[model samples]
Target chain A: MSGDLTARSGGLTLPRIGDRALWSFVGRRIGHAVLVLFCVATVSFFLVRISGDPVRQMLPPDATAAQETALRAQLGLDQPLLGQYVSYMTGLLHLDLGQSLFFHRPAFDVIAERLPATVTLAAGALVVVLVVAIPAGVVSALRRGTATDTTVMAAVLVGQSAPAFFVGILLILVFAVNLQMLPASGMGGIENLVLPAVTLGLYSIAMVARLLRSSLVDVLGEDYIRTARAKGLTGWRIVTAHGLRNASLPVVTVVGLEIGNLLGGAILTEQVFAWPGVGRLTVEAVTYRDYPLMQATVMFLATVFVVVNLLVDLSYAALDPRVRLS
Target chain B: MPVLEVNDLHAEFRLDTGTVRAVNGVSFSVEPGQTLAVVGESGSGKTATALSILRLHPTPPCVYTGGEIVAGGRDLLTLPEREMRQVRGNEIAMIFQDPMTSLNPVKTVGAQIVESLRRHRSLPRGEARARAVEALREVGIAHPEARAGQYPHQLSGGMRQRVMIAMALACRPKLLIADEPTTALDVTVQAQIMELMADLQDRFGMAIVLITHDLGVVAQVADKVLVMYAGRPVEAAGADDLFERPRMPYTRALLESMPRPDVPGGAVLDPIRGAPPNLLDLPSGCAFHPRCGFARPECASTVPALEEKAPGHAAACVLTDDDLPGTSEGRRVSGT
Candidate 1:
């Protein structure tokens, strides 16, 4: 039995696909991501232009035609549409997003300053999602048809149907006003982070938990799980070491898309919670017709969406050898 | 003493429709170093009987109505889940039909083997890893070190079954319940796996409860044979004796169904005309009577007991002892 124990044909060939092959896959994905981002930037520029002129919206109500004209020229809103498109595209090439009309700073700078806040909000919401979803999904799958599973399913249903903004207000009314436990609004320490994170993550948490529960439940019934049991693995090991990794594939895919969904929906959530984030800034820029800031926000979110999906695909390859084969 | 003794094992599925008595009063045993083949068609409770030994049946749906699966001096039926865990991989290991679906797709074959070894033996991590590779080699998998590092999809069907055998036998359990282990492989690969299993049994002195419908497999490896029909054993005897003189009509039909070289070129293969009776609502008497060619009026009203018609040879049919084929009238086995 111990004879012919030598490794086959030289160096490591075990990882399904090698580093160069994986990197090449990533390179192709990056190429696709650039194309998607470029399309979003172009579409946003035209789409935002059709929302009406920022100059007209910013002018005084009783102002004369000449005053409106002067403001338009000063803001470069008077330039021809294609000329404006050229300048915007040129600015993007140099990593410059034009001046924010209201902030009177570079549009990139305005969005960048708020990036940390949005990042923290997204990170906290994700942490909340995983913390809540993992145990809920796993327990529900393991204890299927039990009261605990039914209760979790019911709770997840309520969470799925409740809008983020509505959830945020209800949380504010209960936790902040009634209990006097947490701050009602604005950003600060750990205390301020909890409600907004929960509110923003509510729908995603529901989605992830539901998907995970179903996925895990399906995986637990697989032939290998019975094999695991026959091997004397009980309780946690069978569920975790044998089951969860396979179950997480669908959840991982959903999470990537949900994070993109989370950011888009963060606009309403930030409005309800009064938490300053790029989402809130994007709303502000839209209200005042700040085109550059609007374009910048679109670019930021589009970039985030693209990068997240790329990571998810890469993770799919890493998690399942079947995926790597294709 | 026998390594595994299953007595009057009864198991049922409690579904919305009704209770399904999958295994009803099925009894068999296997001495150490022996192989007992449970032969039956699909849904004949062969798989259920095999699963009952390890208490691996799905519980919400499956309830062990009655049984004693004795292994290593303990009734596995009454043992708590915690103690059952020790008995499972440590005393009796099992392998399934499809090697493709029987492994964790996300895990390497070696890691899966290492997991069971560590679980049962509490081997140190490095030692477990080394044994895992050796186990792969023992199963006749070429380049064991390289194959160990590869995932299930990376290996062929035969290679994966070898890996499964390695995993099941790594701890050298007293009994191994192989449920149609060769059913999913190529014809040539099937022979190779069967040979590998027989060789391993010789080396380890492990008993086997091999559940299969293929009579060819039973004829090749079984020391003893038990034929089941609708969850009840209809015949039990030494393998050679059962083939030579199958007293039960169902067993006779099963034997006749096999394609043999001895049969002439123009001779057609016999197929038992009807389906096996449903477990949920089995026919009143002998479950196979509806399908039996020689079935009589009494066969429908009376369930024949599996009594020993000869020393160590039992059959459930009500045919008289003197009803030999050449001397018989209409009740002969070859009448079909």
Candidate 2:
């Protein structure tokens, strides 16, 4: 113990990635990831089944018994419940999501075709959120209990309470209908991206700004911040370099979850804008009663959420040294 | 002339709930190469007084109502923030009490120290790093370079304190305000840290303002001691005289309350009676009168101004010359 202590005191080094500790962490994450997959599958299976009859939806209105039976057998839908579940799990392990019921294409291909659009839209919105929210949060916190501060906080409150769909409609009414300055909605080009991005990002801006402001308020009162001030670092320097940097963890944590939410819930905005995205594809599947398509889309969204949350957890160790990695 | 002179300083905080008189018309000074220990429990305005020197107190919430904090021949209260920045860390540096939370946990200890050095002096990063290592070594951190890379939580409580001391001394400030620097550590670590501070102070020839509630620490490091009660100075004297003959009742009570190691384990420790008065609803006359066994009728009517009871000892109590009995008499009065 004494020797180990002396060695540790002398110098510290990062542990090897392949070490037991690292492997254990990875193993734990993998276990959690498996559980998440199981949950997604269970929920998706029940949700799609309860939506309507997959068999009737897949078949034509005039199809005969032999034709229906042959189609069911071909799709493995004729299998017993346990057999179907095992087959689905096996397909998942092999990264094979079979053909979409509505699109008449592989589910993987359908999701792949639409994922980039959702990712791009969500990423754009997140960038807008950070660019707008961070400075606003810092400035508001710095100018606490003043007119400017009040104005900023009121804006945040309004943004938080206002729905994204309503904001999207308002943006369209102003930008597209009245001013004719930009496209009302869609993910066609940079010109079309502005309104929807802002609409999707507005609530995030409000949430992140509020979070950051409160975080900065608490952090600025900390002894280290006092020490920084005592060192004669200017107010701007203190806010930007110290206060905001420390306050960003909560913001970062929420950003990941928000991004997942945006990706999943961008259906309304996508519909309003006619953006060719996964959210729109999911909605189309729901309307058509496409069980395979809906299952595949939902499963993908769940995976994104789980992966994002995992990344956020990993970032906790990155942002705060006090969080013991071991 | 004193290196630092605070004359009748009054700092108040207009909290949303109500106004809190943190430092109510208190004053003290520290000469060059001397240690003045401002001893008080939490919320007794000791920390506020230190903050007022740098004008670090946030406005609106913390208002410096009246008085002069003249340090390095300039009134700190009136200095422009830009110039005050130059004075802070360059002339007057502060070490906070909680080492665990004092240093930025995200940044390496070296980065924080070097940041202070870089801000004050136009040193290259390499030179700044060297100075940081030297400062760390001065604070008795073994393998300073290696320790510098490690984060605050990686280090022990004592080590983090050394980092704080290193950071405080990095700029080579004329006065170092150590606000309860060793209060969070274990006894042995506290002794080690105290010794380190004293050793560094001697080497640097910097005056220290040691703000603490520990009388033991006050005895060890202070050249002069300022005892505060309810946001007011109860006693101020040379260290030896204050310890030998604590003039004020509050000081006497505080001294009596400390558990001495020399005393046997079975000896019942005497804690001071009554909690510290709420600053908002402080006692009418002397704040300590409620807790002071030696309170006279006059103590409840008129506030006692801090007056010289002896050549160097000043106490804020109405006790007459003979009322403060001799050491033997004091023991008899306490029935020791």
> In candidate 1, what are the lDDT values of residues A1-326, reduced to their tens digit?
12212332111234334567787888898999989988998999999999987876887789899998899899898999999999999999899989999899999989989887788888889888889888899889988899999999889778879988889999999999999999999999989989999988888888899899999999999999999999999878898887898899899999888887776558988888888998999999999889999999999889889988987787777667677622
| Model 2 residue B273 CA deviation in Å | 2.6
Q: lDDT tens digits, residues A1-326, model 2?
A: 01222223212233446667556766788789889988898778777767876567677898898988887787667888778777777888888776787778999999999988888888888888889898889888888888998999899788778887788899999989999999886667788888888877887888889888889988998888998998988888777667776888788898878888888878877887888999999899898777778888888988888888877777766677666556
TM-score of every model versus the real structure: 0.95, 0.92
Q: Pick the candidate with the highest lDDT.
A: 1
- Best candidate, TM-score: 1
- For model 2, what is the C-alpha lDDT against the true structure? 0.82
TM-score, cand. 2: 0.92
The local distance difference test score of each candidate is 0.86, 0.82
lDDT of 2 at A161: 80
| Candidate 1 wrongly placed segments (more than 4 Å) | A1-18, B324-336
RMSD for each model, in Å, please?
3.6, 3.9
Q: What lDDT is reached at residue A182 by model 2?
A: 97
**Residue B292 lDDT in candidate 2:** 81
